[model samples]
Target: MKNTKKLYYLIGILVLVLLVWMVNDTFTQPGVDDLEMEFQEVAVYRNENNTGPIKRIYAVVVSDTLWHEMEQYGKLMPHTKYGNTQVYFFEDIANAPEKINAQSPYFDASLNPFCIGKYEKKAMGEEHFSKYPFR
Candidate 1:
């Protein structure tokens, strides 16, 4: 009788644990949340045929001059000579990881062509952003 009782208790514990795990799996899967969350608005160019639905967002940086040039062009002009610029755009900047700004060696920290003066920052929403040649 004692062995039977112990078996039943163990089974009950296992069932409880399984139930909790199922609840967690159901609630925490990626893209399953129904909550309305905030997203920074920005723009990007993407081909649905080549890339899947995964949206690449960014923190865009450009110069005031570039801004004016883009305004004149009436759209973004992509330039590939300088490579892709790095601007930090986070979903939650408050809890974002530490980043090496222009002052860091990773950014070359030079004040010449690719310096901070030629940069402006903006959040690229849930879209792929293109690099435009700044006038």
Candidate 2:
């Protein structure tokens, strides 16, 4: 009888955990939430099929002091006869993670670039975003 009671308790606990996970998943925002704000970056991809490049915006934040150190060591980051990496230092506020200036258009993704689903970080690539149904 004691074994039966313990089994029931374990099942109940499992069920409760599953319920909690479902609830959290239901309430969580898609995509945009997954971005690591402190290291936001924006890259422009020049697709061969497209005449114009696609802009992928991101935020990259680093300490002011580190920026200087990197600057000295980064002088010849590319190390070639031409081209270089210029570290632009700015206040953290410039890309404050907590402050989102984005405007979520009506969820009719057909009218906007904001995907109606998950928005993974830039490093993850573009497979996750559905920047479509919109012009």
Candidate 3:
């Protein structure tokens, strides 16, 4: 009878340990709270600067890589900064340059180093309309 009671106690202990482990695992699991934090951080940074009516601007098509060109241009021009710039990806500027023009106020500028030849393309930044011409 004593040995049987010991076996029952052992089983109870094992079950209790398992329950505790499962509870711990569930509590530690990632939840919506983590994602909410990331979104909140993004919102905070975007609204930090209260400036002019945020312009919806698009950049011209370039022959070389899109990111490399945007980075170079952003460094040179204040408006081209990542937060302010919106790039439009195009296969060839000549093929659909009109599409860029149709979208919004677009600046006609090519990547400075044109000798590198054609490569992949990408666009960055949000789209906004200008109250006046891009100039």
Candidate 4:
């Protein structure tokens, strides 16, 4: 009887630990609004192929050039296994692309000069980020 009681106590302690962990995880996670910089999403694209690798792209206009925050925004984007994700940042919505795709040279070359930053997550899960002085 004593051993059974001890086992029950242990199980109860584990349940309490799990509940605390869950609540902590839920509240500590960051969302889009958690970003310190002001930004607007101008465009988004997804290949929408469930049978194969998915591809996602985003174009955003940011009020300022904050490289770390831009990277954080990219990380917040949805990604899938064996998939790719890319983000392009600009200073003005007028220069940001209204449409993007999985194709190479995702956006028009003419807009390159207006891009302020770029972030990419390759299919193999590799990440790349760069900031341009195109302001």
Candidate 5:
């Protein structure tokens, strides 16, 4: 009887700890609206095949150049195991590409000069974020 009571006490403590963690995580996570910078999504692309590695790409336009906010936006993007995610940031909507694909040069060459930043997450989980004047 004593052992059973001790086990119950341990389980109750574990449950309490889990509840606390869940609440804290739910409240502290950042959402798109939580960002201070103003931006608009122009385009998004995701491959159809789900059995293997997936690819996701996004193109957005921002009111101003804020590298930190761009990085934050990239991090907020959804990712999958053994998948690739990319984000292209532009300063003007007219210059932003309306469509993007999983190709190496994701957007049209004509739009290159207009791109302000780029973010990429490789299949192996490595992340790269670069400001344009891309080299």
Candidate 6:
């Protein structure tokens, strides 16, 4: 009888935890339409200034992610200083060059350096993800 009571308590706790998790998820996950890139420029900022709309970010250092040949808010992968990279996304510039896909590890060639003029520090900031000041 004691064992059965313990089992019931465990099950009840599990259900409570699940309910909490579901409620949290419902509040956190953004809608699919809000994530669409057609009307947004995604960014991962790194720092902030005291008197500006500026925020530094662990920008993808890859040359192709930043070029002068692509349009404003062109899509490219966001990278971090820790060697992790996010999905390809549109930066906040139109004229930036599109990043070319890797051909082969042994046959690689260097692309051009990043051009600061091609992007804004704040892309589709809060408009895209209100939780993260990405605009």
- Please list the Cα RMSD from the true structure of every candidate, rounded to 1 decimal place: 15.4, 17.0, 15.4, 2.3, 2.7, 13.3
Across 1-135, the per-residue lDDT of candidate 2 in tens digits comes to 999999999999999999999999998844423433232332111223233323222222333334323233223122222211222222353332332222232122332333211222232232222222233
Residue-pair clashes per candidate? 7, 8, 2, 0, 0, 18
Better of 3 and 5 by TM-score: 5
lDDT at position 126, candidate 2: 22
Give the CA lDDT, 0 to 100, for residue 32 in model 1: 10
Off by over 4 Å in 6: 31-135
> After superposing candidate 4, which stretches have Cα over 4 Å from the reference?
2-7, 133-135
- lDDT scores for all predictions? 0.35, 0.34, 0.37, 0.89, 0.89, 0.35
Worst 10 residues of 2 by lDDT: 80-89
- Candidate 6 lDDT by residue in tens digits, 46-132: 333434333332222222333322223322323223222222233343422234333221111222222232332234431111111
Expressed as tens digits, the lDDT of each residue in 1-135 for candidate 3 is 999999999999999999999999998964423331111110001123445433333333444444444334323323423345333333343433332332222323442222122221112533332211222
User: What are the TM-scores, per candidate, against the unseen true structure?
Assistant: 0.26, 0.25, 0.28, 0.85, 0.82, 0.25
Preferred candidate (lDDT higher): 3 or 5: 5
lDDT of 1 by residue, 1-135 (tens): 999999999999999999999999998764412223323323333223323222221232322334333222222322222233333223333333233432223322221233212222223322132343121
Whole-model alpha-carbon lDDT for candidate 5? 0.89
Candidate 4 per-residue lDDT, tens place, 1-135, comes to 999999999999999999999999999999889989998989888886998999988899998898999999988889898999988999998888888866877888889899989998988889989888345
Candidate 5 error regions (>4 Å)? 1-21, 133-135
Structure candidate 3, residue pairs in collision: 56-128, 56-129
